[model samples]
Target: MLTTRPERWDRVVDAIIVGSGGAALTAATMAHDGGAEVLVLEKASLIGGTTAVSGGVVWLPGNHHMAEVGISDSREDALAYLRRLTCGHEHDPAVLETFVDTAPEVLSYLEANTPLRMQPVANFPDYFFAYDVPGKKSGGRSCEPLPYAVGDEIPEWRDRLVTRGTLMSLGSNTMLAEDFAEPTEELKAELARREAQDIRTKGAALIAMLFKGLLERGVELLLETPVRELIVVDGSVIGVRAEANGQSIFVAARKGVVLACGGYEWNKEMVRAFIGYEVQPLSPPNNVGDGLVMAMEAGAQLANMTSYFGQPAMFDPEISRDGELVPQFEWGRGAPGSLIVNRTGARFANEAMPYNDFPKAFGAYDATQNEFPNEGPGWMIFDQGVRDSTRILSMIPGRPTPDWVPVANSIRDLAALIGLDADTLEATVATFDENASQGRDPLFHRTELGLMAPGAVRPLNQGPFYAVVIWPGALGTNGGPRLDTNGQVRGYRTPVIDGLYAAGNTAASAYAWAYPGGGATIANGMVFGFRAGRHLAAQPARDI
Candidate 1:
């Protein structure tokens, strides 16, 4: 039998937060800072959840950091982006407006009270729709947390620190393959050295930085503890019943219990029922919608169940265990220098569109052919130039370059490898290559269409061309319990569920169609988490 920690019960916190991802941690920090005793319960042995494994950038438009750098942004522009993206997507306007208006204040609070710092991801464009929007910084607004301060200032969390690529590093930029072009031998050597030294990179570094701050503030984290149900008394949420160390621990919350546990990305039954497809998930394994189930049990109404945020993710079915397939994030099939095609040997939507748009478009493609959603495995094709110029991170074993199988010297050969019609594949490649040569992809209208960079370019004439099968994978499901402006759960015949709140992927997102930025999910979590914490902390103790 596994040795479990002795069961210890406590009911003294001002708030009890489920899931220690960005949302939960942010709320815990806010409640603790507001003089409320906060307890964070995480089902995973590690605390960060999906946030720890993600690209640690948050999209905060009109933020204080933007002003610090002399870039002026307004609420109007932000709202316009929201309107353009959501476009009749069942989002509450009030909540959307609040997210835009109060973004700066949330940034201010974090800078003032926490170790988290912010910086803009320069030159990156908003997925696509905001290309012509005024006052929109090309890359608009994305921020990263600064490195953690070393020493015993924060305890125990050091061991729990999450690192990228299973190592530790500091001040490393989360650049895509394009970002590493012309990587000097010195830089490559340095990266290897860092990898050898076991430095934490990207999201891992950011989570560790935030965890350090939470620890310094005396916040208590209960890992491997799962909240089984919410404690509601007389139409108001009072606390939670959790499974901790093989015992039922009932923790009372004088303020509120914030649910930031992620969506049901890994729940196969829920995904097939709700999303209408079988998709490999890109989020952490623990995101099984425990919070959503608990909230629904307490009468929370859900929204956007038919929709999901999707990405063009690399798929390897053979490596799957217990019906769960691993998803590759760094190797984007539709990044700058590549294009995606369906099994019918026809190019579908713009591969360069945001990941969310890709899967939705794929679903549309499947619908057009009267096939099951996500039925046709997608293909990514690129030239040797792309191979040399881009940093394509693949999992092929013992190869200096990222390995892409199913390659051929001719379209017919490639088609045979990918199981596509020979003539159709030849015609498709001919048209694509013609358009690429002339800087015009008429079919998909890929923006900024151009030839592969000089160094990264390899002629398609090379024998043995490459292809990889892809599927509609997701970071997480977007649909969940509907939340009001103040992060309160909504129900029929009720204005809002008092003392019940949600944040992160558990709450329905404002961006239902287009992804606003790379770190928008984390931003939503932090923003709503802060709002829910303050709103609950300000409530009278009797509201509990």
Candidate 2:
């Protein structure tokens, strides 16, 4: 794990991959196995990017393992489901078909060739699984990597991992796809007993195995190497210019270059321009959209530029962890005995909707005869009943309350503190309670979403309430360079750019509008990344 960037430059490799996340590493391993020399460049100091901090679930419909578990899925069904989910968005049909057909193939390849093995999550249901669509499914598409056993004798790799810290200390990844989080008393005791053993779960285990596979395939990885721009020879991308160890280095690509350097959530300008709202990113700061910018400069067309993969988040202005203020995701939205409302103190979308669809409710537009206000934040209000039954974020069950959470004995006081209409808040709570008693939502229908538990429908009429300000937050942007089915980066209104490719967050996502399930991004990232690697290896070597 103690690796350094090479001081040499002007060298050529069969394929140059600009990233070191799951996508980039998958590409590198496949390229090397295809009998081509592969080099991977990561802008961050460490190899694993944001993918390491994610929930580590991969959504692969009709994957080989599902049938073994008695769950049925097919390639045709997956395509139909994707088509229904995407609606009327302009996208390459060939690319969509390739994603569906090759999703399981890539999984099989990784399991057989690499150190990675995934098991289907039986309890995790789809966001739209309740519907009667032709290709609809109930569960088993989501697969999670098994935790890495401790005492493997890799201390250096263990030291390099970055934890999500307070944000995920108690988060629930999934029942079957669960990571090492939300430790109960018994689990805490077990973790303490195994503290020195260095058991890694979730993203840490995923990247470790991928890196091991890459090393076995003889792929060269260079960390702290930020690609500046693509090197074009007569309108065809042939290589990349990057910064390595404080020096400009030009590396030629004899076959192609794959851009998988994540997305632009940390780039304030890009976030402001596309989302039209202030956001606190859930991803690391290194995801500054360098690949996205470079692709645009290379005349690549952008898709889904106005949309992003985001959820609701907020900050505790007074609470700092590790001497810095900790911004927490508003998981309280789905907690029982709670409700979210706008400044007017009226409920908008279903509070229990899928996390990916929650933020979109704030920005929905009607264009026939435009009727909407600007996108804005909301107030998450809850009662002490919730504080008793569930953990409201960092709040301890019986500990003394902190000043960061605005509290009041009455709903009026809580509304006033959060700058909401007290009367409207009272009315909203009263009506919601009446509907909850009967298990009916004439409005948003929280029970129908399938993402929320019945606990989310508990009444909210108890005294002593709490509230917090929450805003739309993105984990990463899904827009970037367009690509064909074969993973070649596409130019605007023209043919594919020679020797240039994109995958992961740097490529415009196929399902631009909807999130298929838990591991939509990673599954697509790996599938297309492997495609880019094999495609680049098959091409004739450049004469540069």
Candidate 3:
């Protein structure tokens, strides 16, 4: 077992936070406000993990902003929607209730305590719709943080943040939370202007705000310092052991430790063991289950190991720039002349479904054919016009099709290129085009959703069709050490491990199947991180 010499502690604080993203930074800020001296440690040299490279939207149903923004959503309505979403998982009712009740508190707290400011995404829809209730189809509850100018904020830490991992931060382009309401030519011009301006939006802005808050709170943060093991004494977690500059250092925590050190996406062994498949990872490479392993060695109970957030992405060997495999999230699947078909050349899913829910369609099993994955490698079929209109991942839109991307002269040729029956492909396109011409998808009813844009429902009748093999690209693993509402990590059999807490992807997700809306993942982390920090700060100081 790994041990720590508390008497030789290098640094001691009331709270020690693991990771340096939204969750850790928020926890540090709150813990400091709660009168706890804090130290944040990040394994990576960069401060933001995937959170710094993502859309920094927070999905909080029934938040106060909903009412203020003219959204008529209630707590009961949010609960009912959640129950509908996770009803099959047999999840603890209290967790959902706590999230629903405390989400507003998390948002209000950030608004009051930090530089983070958010506005409601009045038009954003839940990844899944309200099947049984009215006004639940499209979510009016989602909100995104306002963008921050890099020159205006932390000019020194500019390069230390993770910006290349997300579409919003790609190149010099950045998008505002409110700009998503409508796509106009004027909007394009504005977007171009912002892209040239070096503005930080979405996830970057969130981390910047949180980082600024932490710095202001006097929290000491160490980059490239990984927690190697837990320091346990008499079955109690007293501190964590880490290595920096080839020296073993133990940081003592007087009150508690909040583990927000991300998830196990980069760990292939854990991926196969938990998610039942080997998926191309899209999260930061350092997310290799380090936190989960350390917690388990300390007797923490891990649960919901099978849940993950993923989407279909083509990992083209030639066009894989910066390991950009998944174009589904960036270009999105719903171009006017595109359709995703199974091995049988039949349209199996609503092409307009959000990427998170779209992955579930690939889970179809063909028992009669003995195919374990009936929809394996759903070929995304598009026409030259579609490719010409918009960018598909690393490949620029309106540009000639590259040799790396599979293409053909017609639907039959595309089917043959992708190993599908020509007749079936032709028929599927004929039926789909007929429906799309009328803005109707009678086969799957994709565009019927209130959340899906009408532009996504256009016809695919143009010539010179193209196809590409795509598989589910995992964003990250969601399962990890179990925690109570207070974010206190629980032991295998014990109710709670006293000085232990977890938040973000380091812990099992409360809702796992389908994404609630945009920024749901970050919002979950923020809410839980808020709880963990408050709970830890409320505790009396303990002697190291």
TM-score of each: 0.86, 0.91, 0.89
RMSD of 3: 3.2
The model with the greater TM-score, 1 or 3, is 3
Which stretches of candidate 3 lie above 4 Å from their native place? Answer: 1-7, 129-140, 163-165, 168-173, 178-199, 316-332, 367-370, 421-443, 450-460
Best by TM-score: 2
CA error at residue 6 for candidate 3, angstroms: 6.2
lDDT of 1: 0.70
Ranking by TM-score: 2, 3, 1
Provide the overall lDDT of each model, using Cα atoms, as 2-decimal numbers: 0.70, 0.76, 0.76
Give the per-residue lDDT of model 3 (tens digit) for 144-224.
777666655777887787553455214334454444446677767776665565567777778878888887777889998
Q: Compose the digit string of candidate 2's lDDT tens values, residues 137-158.
A: 6677888776554247345656
TM-score of 3: 0.89
Query: At residue 157, what lDDT does model 1 achieve?
Result: 57
Deviation (Å) of 364 in candidate 1: 1.2
